[model samples]
Target: MNTSLKALAVFIALAGSAWAEDLQDLPDDTLLGEVVTATENGEEERLLDLMREVQARGLLMFPKPQTCTFSYPDTEFFGNEIFRGAVRWGFGTDLRELAMSQGFCGCIYDLGSLDAFTQERIGKPAQDATTSDFSVFRKYRRSDWSDVNERYQNFQLERCGS
Candidate 1:
């Protein structure tokens, strides 16, 4: 009986060590973070971390303005320069709300920033606020307003209970 108990204990110890070794060999993604510490350039790491969090939370997106002068270049509806600036500098959430409420265009602000620039721009978890899922609304638009509007409208309808 004593010899058998010793053998059992030895087997348990070996199994435990093997399990620990397997855990150590697991990938970084299996952990909570990317673990880019070895290449830690502070600025780059900070930016990458923010980007990772944004992607992880799925908030790195935004829609386009519905009534963009870009589509009707000849028509100056809201003072071409003013309209452009408004799109550039205006709060993304406000723009999204305006599009859904008034225009054909739809907007979604997905950029993750904890600092509140405007009431609408308070970036938080998507589960916290439905609108925080920018990817659900529109992708990061560079130019095509029409595509952005279409995507946003679909997203709003799907996610925001439109």
Candidate 2:
């Protein structure tokens, strides 16, 4: 091969290897944190890029197992619901469509219900809560996962059902 072709091939190979390495190094929490930060900053383009990267890498092949925690006090619990709603629904149609296509229906439904629940409880827009407020609420919540999926399912059925 000519010198130019040889250099181009080497560059492509290096870029491919670097991308594979980056995908291997990415963790679920890291990806989730980046998504949350993007939402907080209203970085729609960044969010779309991250979602595209996730799809291209096949990082989230299956919906992550849901973990329901019912130990949070009422305020913190409600705040978390609002935060999750904001984070999920905050994504633009393109991002939401990408995620749904990738099998994130359950997550979308659950967070949507959470957002609806907060609206009913507070009787106002829950999007007013800041990311900082969510961080503080998260700090106080129990890390232990509870088997409260049934309760949430019922709520979703009631609040998010067509």
Candidate 3:
């Protein structure tokens, strides 16, 4: 099989597993509907509190940016780190939105995008950190960042049904 076919196989396997897993512990559709109703009813505080509560409960998670190490000596830089970008999202881009805009219906929400949306709804900017001085996930290693990001995506699925 070609590389694209191999990737498709992996995607199928992951999707199948995600579907096969018993998510009985997660909120049902009715609960998710209530949350959506809160969004429409302007219960910002309740929504925010719910978001935080779920995160605290391990049902929601945060996604830190991944980075790679770089080495340079001529410029007096040694083993500095740089962001490597998420699986499909760029530093500030919304991967799920991009995919949906391209007409994909089965894609789940990207945690970065979901977090940014929630923050923006609460009148704060997205994590929006940059390397101009320091990064928000400055203390996080690449592996940790990726793990949290994947969990965050799962949280979106669990809480928001995306």
Candidate 4:
């Protein structure tokens, strides 16, 4: 099979597996709704919390005894780290919007045409340090700044300001 076909197969497998997990333990309906909305907007695919919640809800929605139990890590994602990284590189406005929407203070780093989710742990700097630099995971490295900008423009032209 070609690479695209292989990727499709993997996607199918993961989606199926994800659909089979349960999450009745989490009870915050508001958070659940936010997650669902963000996902629908194509933003939270790489968010660990959102993904975990989705898996849980999928399991509850499916309710199969033969399903597998999955686990997620304990970490803070998107917000702080994306800010620091983007600021370090002096990214663009759209990229900054992406980070701010995810929790960055501003968008200084222009990822060009790349879309990424910064999903890493937050770290604390020493008192002597001048900046609060953090690390993030490119969980969804397939997206870039240009992709985001184009999408935003299309959204505005097609949906918002029309």
Q: Top TM-score: which candidate number? A: 3
What would the per-residue lDDT of candidate 4 be over residues 48-157, giving only the tens digit for each residue? 56556545333233334543221122234223455434422323434545543443221224323222221122222221112233323222232465566565555434
Candidate 1 vs candidate 3: which has greater TM-score?
3
Clashes of each: 1, 0, 0, 20
What is the TM-score of candidate 1?
A: 0.21
- Residue pairs whose backbone atoms clash in candidate 3: none
lDDT of each: 0.39, 0.45, 0.41, 0.39
Q: Which ten residues in a row have the lowest lDDT in candidate 2?
A: 139-148
Task: Residues 65-101, candidate 2: write the lDDT tens digits.
Answer: 5653322224543456666543333322223343334
Identify the leading candidate in terms of lDDT. 2
- Total clashes for model 3: 0
Candidate 2 or 4, higher TM-score?
2
Answer with 1 or 2, whichever has the higher lDDT.
2
The TM-score, computed over Cα atoms with residue i paired to residue i, of candidate 4 is 0.21
